[model samples]
Target: MYSSPEQGGLLLSSLCLLSSLLLNTPLCYGGKILVYPVEGSHWVNMKVLIEELYDRGHNITVVRTSTSPYIAEKSPMYTSITIQNDIVFHDFFDSFIEMQIKAQREGASALTFLKLTKDFLSMIGEAHYLSCKVVSQMLDDKEQVKRLQEAEYDLLLTDPAITVGLVLARYLNLPVVLNVRWIASGEGHFAIAPSPLSYIPVSGSGFTDKMTFIQRIQNMLFKSIIMFQQNFVVGPIYEAMCTKYFKDGCDIISLLQEADIWLMRSDFVFDFPRPTMPNVVYIGGFQCKPAQPLPADLEEFVQGAGEHGVVIMSLGTLVNKLPADMTDQIASVFAKLPQKVIWRHLGKPPSTLGNNTLLVNWMPQKDLLGHPQTRAFVAHGGTNGIQEAIYHGTPVLGIPLFFDQYDNLLRLQERGAAKILELAKVNGPSFEQALNQVLTQTSYRENIQRLSSLHRDQPIKPMDSALFWLEYVIRHRGASHLRTSANRMPWYSYHSVDVFLLLLAAGGSVLLTTGLLIRFFWRTCQNSKNKIKKH
Candidate 1:
């Protein structure tokens, strides 16, 4: 078909403009970054991150497994990919809810259902297997393979929950950056803990406690189990499966070892004397923002408390199932406190005798922390809670329940911003005493406010720093320079003591050989002397 002269001119002009942008500007569409989030809360943070990057003139793509009402209600500011393969946020959640209810009816609890869904995430090292599965499901998935093979992204950032991003990066030969919102579990040996406290057992002994002989033995067994599972069992099985299906060589740990950077959600102010690799960066509080206004009724209720304002109590997301006994203890303790307590009691309380205390199913934590009347926070010490409290300069009294909560509270105690009370010992008197101390004592509040000021006065916003590093990775073909020595070193070399023992064993072996040789020579000479005398 012959085109009009004007149409031909317009096409030529568009081509010229595209060529000019490529040749003249650093901003290009090809420097794409892919991010994978774990679940609900993590997705919220990822949404903020992607928006910032999108504003910075980069094409950003978010890959998520499920959607929540919380996320759906929020403004859709960025493009995302969900299981149904669409960017419609509401549609994704609608599909998810339907699938979830069906699965739930088939004898599945919420936790179990979520876990089962997460398991579908393919092991990154088993690229061959995943590729085969993809092909087997949809032989003519032109768009999917095209996206994979386009060589578009320079880096991949992902949460640990969906570690499949590691494989994606390996397949594409892109740099990987991990955004660790939660502390690494004791089970995973691949992650490097940037903070000293990150090494502490989440549920057990404090960092200061010495390990028992049995505990030491258990530690060894645990490490051995991890090695066996990752290297020999799960890893090899996945690799072989991949090979059988897709005929591609896949090695998960090798792929993980290739990650260029680990950006931790921690800061020196919160995590002191942390051991970090050269490549690991503390970008905690990144994208942390203050909460909006509280409900009018809650605000007035808090304001009416005057000098003895409301203390916020929350057990965080996971440990909402407080036992009746524990709830009674909390209720009794709050009844005695001079301050009004706003407890986020997820279930029915054991007893209700306090006129001063209020129980609610949900509370705006950041809003409460930032409120002028907020005195102190009684919490389970989730990383998010700590950050929000510290960010708002409110002191906290942490009643840690499980998994990293103790360690998190301990760190807060060290900072003089929070106090830790073992749940076993959190009775009425002890709780009241701790609450009184934090409310009356100037030191805790003073220290916390001071740290908050320092946090606020940082050179740049945390999100901006994160965005800069993220975009920089895409621009520079990934931050390969940020990778650590641990990635390159052998397992034995990683432990200096092992090398020392190896040298000591070699020296002992040499000395023993020399002594045996000397004894043999001496015996032979004596035998010769005896034979001469007999002659």
Candidate 2:
């Protein structure tokens, strides 16, 4: 017999509460933490966390991505390692590269190719959804299950990139934590940057908040598209490939769905009104200690910016392909600033420069943030950049380019931690004013500092909380308590407004018709009686 949705909800809620309580209680056993890093930042943060955990006497075993050559440069750690081969699709490589060549030759934007790739991947994602049966078959592979069993990890930790790990986690007798590398969403978990876009109901227009019927539908549709792109397109394509190559039989989505905890690499103080899940934690500021000492010249550059010293400007790695005009505009803007600027401009410096501005290829970002005189940040508003600025209690002037950067800056501006200069409109005059506004404003400084303090004051550092919760699940045999409230109900049932309105309309119509019939019959009877008495 199927359990009522209410009972399921109650069961899930009870499980979550019990698991949370158990996790909070100290236990004698602290098991090994298995970490997976797919990107450069992941490698950096995971190394820091693993070392910290190892220092605290936890055994660390790493299931790292083979693609990252940067791991070889890492400092020696006592942790055990098993590097998994990255799942690269040969067909996808051929197709994407061909498209890239065509776009390059035609002078068509790479953005167009990106769109096509995204759409193709999204369709593939949908295919996986439709082929859930095939996924179910793959996940049933016993050999893959045995690998997880053999790892004997007390807890499994993975970056959000390889969601297939999540599926493996479900079969293994260990607690699982997802380390989010970016803004967190439908992972059905919390991380550093909660889905700001997910929660905010985007009603149209400048002033009033009401959305027209059509607009409301459109909003939901658009939001669904975005969610689909993340969950189905990028995420699924990765998982499908992993399942095929690993022969693990487990689809990535299934793995992601099974995660018990979320370690958001973010400072919660920076992100306000975050969506809370049972086991999610924010620890965004963690980074591996830099290998080399800052060069004397770089140190001198930073130190020289004593009183009105540092304005750190960096567009991050991805968006460094800026046009010459934009680069010139940035240099021109910095020349006008009163404070000394330390710029990580990958391109050559503009011919015209004020003595206060210093441009270079790169700077140690975390070290720069640690500096006391570092007043304001000029950033692309990447998630990592935003959290670092917040952790250091520095405000920002965000010149967002694309993707999550737009949403990231919007939240920062809303929180009074930063100001926004749209990519399309940024020029010397506006850029200079933005920098001045961020650097001079007392409120921005105060606001970000207050948030940083709150973030630091959490009962547990996000990393520890993530570890604790994962172990709790393992100890409790997959605590099963932390499942989402949404999982208890079907999709239709979760969206109950349609059912509610339908019932209300039917009941109202019935009541009104009954009342009208009664009135008509009573009048007819009275009229008949009067006629009879007169006769």
Candidate 3:
């Protein structure tokens, strides 16, 4: 069929546009970025972003501690400014993990939960206090402060887990972008967004968005605990830092609320739906991508399983080894499974060790999860691992240990994509049973696959979306317009309690005036009636 001239011109235009899109990159102009990342797993999450920004032709400078375990002093992607660490994160978390393991081994109970919460808060407070000192030291360094000021970077991208970055950004007067899911207070949402205890569950509450009356009470109690931790424990440390640094008073929460963008490490696919702000961008699985080629030996081992496939297990970076007896129990379960097992265990070999299981110090987790031979992921329910599992459509057999792991796993269990076993309840038989159920249940695989589909079906990939928002901020300076006025409002004003109270007072005044007037008229009429009767 021959097209008309007008139609031909339109076709030509469309083709030219397509060519322009495919041939040219979207992020062209590069800008200098200053990164303030937290140590440990948070660094792992932030690294993906730094690398992407680096490849896009941006100059990256990292501020790290002298004793940092993960973020090296030298890197090809970014320059580093190594500063003295008041507290070494590696040692701090190591001891914290040991305490957690000991607590779990004691037993799980209400008291145990509260005690752990207390201990967790204590550790958190110490870390934060030390971090505040570090920031103080950084600012006190006139030479380094001058260096940072002279560089005149476009923005500061931070994890805010430590939150020293917030103060640093404030001092530099740079546009702040947070690669955040957590702050010292709690989950990032509670501080900036409207979080109703009725639906939005506290991080450790284990309640989903739909809460029962009793569950809501429990959530409220948990929320109060977070408030206590924030106000009494962590808040003061940063507040003091703010006081010392700025002659003008500063509130830590205000600094966080004033951030230009929140590149939230969450999306609706993983996190439950809740009220959020305009500056908060959801990029849940931004770090996830197609798996690269596996190492030769790992591929051959995966192939050996043939029809049975592979079950990959890792407890994440924080926990080095499980309790000795618990390790033995888990190893026994792996021994019986027909599927080839790749267990990332650093502990001594279990007495019940089996030939079918490959015990490695570490494995290529992302690549292994993406492989077709992978059947299910045995994980500790860290956000990164769970998101990766969802990305690869792998069902989870979650052994949640400490902090928000249970909550992370709960999301999967709620979706029928996972099974959760308690630390105290995980005997050899129970471990075997849970593993079998995850493997045999067709629905587990199907449900996670559906989530994978949903997560994948987005207008833009999470990474790209995050980058666009970041560059958007750089191009336009701070995104204060997207920030809500509620941040500046006092508690009473924010909830409009003042307005409600004002209306109530007005109503009460009118009622009081009417009642007094009626009483006065009744008395006057009675007096007049008496006088008339007397006459």
Best-performing candidate as measured by TM-score? 3
Please list the residue runs of candidate 1 whose C-alpha ends up more than 4 Å from where it truly belongs after superposition. Answer: 1-31, 66-75, 84-143, 147-151, 181-205, 209-252, 290-292, 349-353, 425-430, 453-457, 493-535
Output the number of the lDDT-best candidate. 3
After superposing all C-alphas onto the true structure, candidate 1 shows an RMSD in angstroms of: 11.7
lDDT scores of the candidates, listed in order: 0.65, 0.62, 0.91
Model 3 ranges off by over 4 Å: 1-4, 11-28, 524-535
Range of the 10 consecutive residues with the lowest summed lDDT in candidate 1: 119-128
lDDT of 1 by residue, 185-223 (tens): 232223553322224332223542245666555555544
lDDT of 3 by residue, 1-535 (tens): 4368889888889999999998885554788899999987899989999999999899999988898889999999999988876457778788888888788878878898878888889999998887777778889999989999999999999988888898999999999999999888779998889888889999888889989999999999999999999899998888888888889868779889889999999999988999999999999999998999999999999999999999999999988888888889888889888999999989688998899999999899999999999999999999999999999999999998878899999999999999998877888999999999999989999999999999999998999999999998898888999998878888899888999999999999999999999999999999999999999
Candidate 3 has what TM-score?
0.95
Q: Tell me the RMSD of model 2 versus the true structure.
A: 11.2
What are the per-residue Cα lDDT tens digits for candidate 2 across 488-514? 466577679779888999999999999
Report the CA-based lDDT of candidate 3 relative to the real structure.
0.91
Pick by lDDT: 1 or 3, better one: 3
